[model samples]
Target chain A: MTNQQCGTSRIAGCQFTLHPMSDNFVDIILSALDEVDSTKVWKDTDDVTTCVRGKMVHVFDVTKAIFLHAAKTGEHVAMSGTFSIGCPGDNEADVYMAESDEPMNLEKSQTIDQQAGCKFSLYPLGREDYMDKIYEQIDLSKARGVEVSASHYMTRLDGDVKDIFNAIEESFVAVQEKVSHTTMTFTISANSPSNK
Target chain B: MTNQQCGTSRIAGCQFTLHPMSDNFVDIILSALDEVDSTKVWKDTDDVTTCVRGKMVHVFDVTKAIFLHAAKTGEHVAMSGTFSIGCPGDNEADVYMAESDEPMNLEKSQTIDQQAGCKFSLYPLGREDYMDKIYEQIDLSKARGVEVSASHYMTRLDGDVKDIFNAIEESFVAVQEKVSHTTMTFTISANSPSNK
Candidate 1:
């Protein structure tokens, strides 16, 4: 998966925002940030979102950690994130591409207990059979034990937070194997009043 | 657009989640919902998201109003939503297809003054030249006076809340003119601590 072979850089990254449904949202957000070990990825926080760039595994590892950490606080939390790989002309984060694939926060994240409901859409850019790829991933999602259903423009996933995240991460990584440039956008909600 | 021509339904809908960064999030969310005029659209709220289905114009009108109303309260607010049209096998919402084009809440939404920062990704599914459509819309977004810039997995947009929503709505409708199945995912944030 070299840049030259795909005409797009192999570096993967995610830009995500966390919203905690509490007046103390700032505390929840900051505290969650404090718990995640993001050293393996190149991270920057801006006014709108925080972006983590590096190996695909590391990017998912850190973003998943941030969300799980926030959810463990027992507050209603929602995370919106976009993950991309094989972005054309995206060389700015190439330095992090050399980082190892080992995830720094997976062990800690696995211990968090929470339920999540999510909806996601995947774009395998430039593929004529994009629907086939999307449907394939949907099938995989159901096999992973997350309750799956079709909704307008996206797929709904419901289950334990860990299982839900695993389904998302696996499908994302699996799609990248065949498509050089792929991007997915998703929103995960936990402990919402509507759920009660 | 007819279902027979596109092999998909013409019904447009949006599933959205609004997160207000305050302990009184429930009040903020409910208050904003109360202020919106959603009579033109079919709306249903569940544990994770609120789905509004109807004519495209009304769908955007309601979602944009809810976000703007929440932002007007001067509290930090973020909205995550997916706007989709031409979804195959989505006949459940076909009843909304008969709604009028008139937007029910446009005039009132215009009165809200707030700045917003947003990131969005558009998917014109099953098109080989999908990138062209996406880049064209990026150009359109710029022409609308919103600050546009490329980011990982999505494009960043910044401007007054109304202008931001307008750019998004226009671009979304523009693409639907050429492609039958299109879906867009976006995140809009206002009054964040990071911005301060």
Candidate 2:
């Protein structure tokens, strides 16, 4: 129903918004944001690196906590992981994938795994500028291969699937107004009927 | 300030939270975000390819916009040119940092101009991780370098400089509780008038 175009880089089985111009989004964004009750600042270099590399972002913390929440609320297995990437910060020249590890046992390229919920780029419109930074983190993770992951700064979060999705939505709307273009792909694991 | 650990990486002119316990970042985030709005999403793969080159996420709209932003806000003159790497939204695997035809122009590794403020990653506490990704993007800027950019999703933003240092305090708190482990780094840009 929106004027925004859909992205080819989609997250396998899910359909998410790209760049919607509807008025509804702005209000949702304003309402969605949370208040920072307290602030904790890192004092040293060691701490900064350690925190980001160590899955120190609040969102990431929330991601882990959500898994625990699932377990606490009595769900099946709770899966969790941490992603890390090393950055030198500036390149006089040259380009490289942040994470270049090839996934083993790949039957084909870009094949969606219904079971694992294989995803593709959900890159949206007008957001072409930020891709390098965001995906570099992904590259940082893939470089580590299945054994490791990168790019979860302040993104840790969890709750009911809807809640988790809300957080993601909130994260997007949170940044939406400022960025003119944004497209995303999401792949959600199908919930087993038994869980409910 | 709070008690956090060491970090995994470092880079040029890092900036991150100083105290582990600070204040609300959501408002700061909303205020700081730079919007790339009101543009068409590039859909045709061939058109997208021609706009940038090689493998990329392919958003011609954003790629063009950043160039415009640079041309509009930066000191350089003579605009009409193609991306060193390619256009935005090339559907490439990684975030790309297009070559700076005029790249900082340092015979040795000189620092990026930090005249513009509000670079959270540049903060001392957050530098290592920020630098890690930047360096990685630089190494992989060509084939994969496009993936590592401020435009990409992974990169932390240099949000509005207005009233932001205050928010840095909040970002830390959110992250501390979100991520499992944390550390930080901070530095005053060597080129700043304050330093000069």
A-chain TM-score, model 2? 0.26
Q: Can you tell me the CAPRI class of model 2?
A: incorrect
TM-score of chain B of 1: 0.91
User: In model 2, what is the error at residue B68, expressed in angstroms?
Assistant: 5.8
Q: Which stretches of candidate 1 lie over 4 Å from their true place?
A: A1-7, A141-145, B1-7, B141-145
Alpha-carbon runs more than 4 Å astray in model 2: A1-21, A35-58, A61-196, B1-62, B65-196
Q: Compared with the true structure, what per-residue lDDT tens digits does model 2 show for residues B69-107?
A: 332332211111111111121233222323222322121
Cα deviation at B14, candidate 1, in Å, is: 1.5
* Cα displacement (Å) at residue A43, model 2: 16
Interface RMSD of each: 6.2, 21.0
Model 1 residue pairs with clashes: A22-B22, A23-B22, A23-B23
Residue B13 deviation, candidate 1, in Å?
1.7
